[model samples]
Target: MTTTALGIREYKRGLTDLGNGAYAWLQPDGGWGWSNAGLVVDGDESLLVDTLFDKYLTAEMLGAMQRAEPAAAEIGWLVNTHSNGDHCNGNELVTGAEIVASKACAEEMAHESPAMMAKLMAHAPEMGEVGEFFLHCFGNFAFEGIEQRPPTRTFEGAFDIRVGDKDVHLQQVGPAHTAGDVLAWVPSERLVYTGDILFIEGHPILWAGPVQNWIDACDYIEGLDPALVVPGHGPITDLRGVRAVRDYLVYIRDEARKRYDAGMPVLEAARDISLADYDSWGDAERIAVNTSVLYKEFAGDHGPNDTQALFAMMAQLHKERRG
Candidate 1:
């Protein structure tokens, strides 16, 4: 199969050097917390786009990077694109680096501490449906030793900074995937590390959404026309990939809207929606959460999500799919 400069289609896990001081760390079958990260190097400085789910995973990525580029051993700037554990749980591993994130993301990070995951993992085996769903979604990572080091610096909108001599643009485009989602755009190299904004081959879970915001995020990516787009999950893609994601969101939103207007329950709508077109996408069970969020948004509800309930519903969807 043909591959893009930083594609992860062939590798389950590893780093791909995109040339000219940019690299992408891929974790394939990008399901659950299995996400991807990026590294930008210039002169003697290195900027880490995001970290992995746990310390060991982050260490392995860093070690691979260090071997490929000696300067990677000391990351000067660490950017957390969002508040997801897969992207920031390894922040503590970067010790002295100046960590940065959007103001909203930093706040979200605090609420989803590593201890939260530890607690969930600890009780997962005993909790029935919620536990089954939770473990099914997040059981792969080691959450015990994560120290939960959040970003030291925060920004509200677009910000520009340097990784050595390369200019990295941090653009906040969230309240979509999360409260704060940023895109790390290396304009000079024509590459963008789109933090959960683009999930290439997987169904993106809408933990937070207006749905339109997520669609707009894709438009923003296409507007940039980056040569390589490294998503928070899945392989690297170009403008076409961005369009696919946008199209999926648009399709689901329209489908869910019709059901919402008819007063269908969220779970029923999720189950009723045909995913035959997206059947090949990983994590098809996420349709449950996506439909639920879309339903809530359609009803003008902006309340906090009932995460456990959502997971239980997803668990049900998964079982149905399996059977």
Candidate 2:
């Protein structure tokens, strides 16, 4: 295990046994497409939480889990925390496991397919700076030819299922990180696997939010009083990490609101906002997307975000920061 400057202990890449048959799959320098996943096991039954950005990564994770725990040889259920490609793109590899997700996540996944990603990567060379930024973020992952296997089971609000004698609770706490983000809670183990809800030391990109919903989601996770919190990215943390994320959201929301009231443009506000407090976080350029979403929310625009335009803004901001 390696510790960050902030004193957070980060585990090595692969399965970390969390005792009681709970394991976390961590990818170092958890930024962009490098995401984390979890495995919960009881007796001969096991439930897998999320997947990696591609089949190879997911296959590696599965292999590690199966080697560590015999129950993981055949996952009884695969729970996708959200619809992000990093979390659900490898769903096809789980085989016969009953893939489960939030109703909103399932719908979102239908549109954000691996084929779409492959197409984007194929055209990245022609897109100039935006494409460069895209390649920088996702180039390492293979998107071509991966089948999109959506959820076979979906629910709204909350759902409950069992893995052996332990009960795992699924709570839909989004329209925050994504349209339908879910938190998988193993009540008996006092453990919670938060999708992208908690980015730990990284800046979270708000693809869907009113900001308040994300804050409330953070509160809900805190309310659970979990002993072990496995975040979607970065190291395992407790309520402190959750509050840090919430604080960042609140800071950005208020800062963006002031700029909005002064009639500043979204891109300008994103660039102007002081990130001194969060300077240590990875992917600070995500402020471009977060600020843009907050500006739209302030304007009472509930429309879908112009993704390509956002990526362009992020590319510009990323370049500026690098310089």
Q: Model 1's lDDT to the true fold?
A: 0.89
The deviation in Å at residue 39 for candidate 1 is 0.2
Clashes of each: 0, 0
**Lowest-scoring 10 consecutive residues by lDDT in candidate 2?**
1-10
Q: Which tens-of-lDDT digit does each residue in 1-323 have in candidate 1?
A: 23442343354579987888888999988888989999999999999999999999999998999999999889999999999999999998887899999999999988888887898899999998778878888888889967888889999999898888899999999989899999999999889999998998899888899889899989988888887889999987878889999999999999999999998888889999999998889989899989998988988998999987888888888888989
RMSD of each: 1.8, 2.6
Regions more than 4 Å wrong, model 1: 1-9
How much is the lDDT of residue 43 in candidate 2?
A: 99
Relative to the unseen true structure, what is the C-alpha lDDT of residue 282 in candidate 2, on a scale of 0 to 100?
A: 96
Per-model TM against the reference: 0.96, 0.97
| Model 1 residue 312 distance off true place after TM-score fit, in angstroms | 0.7
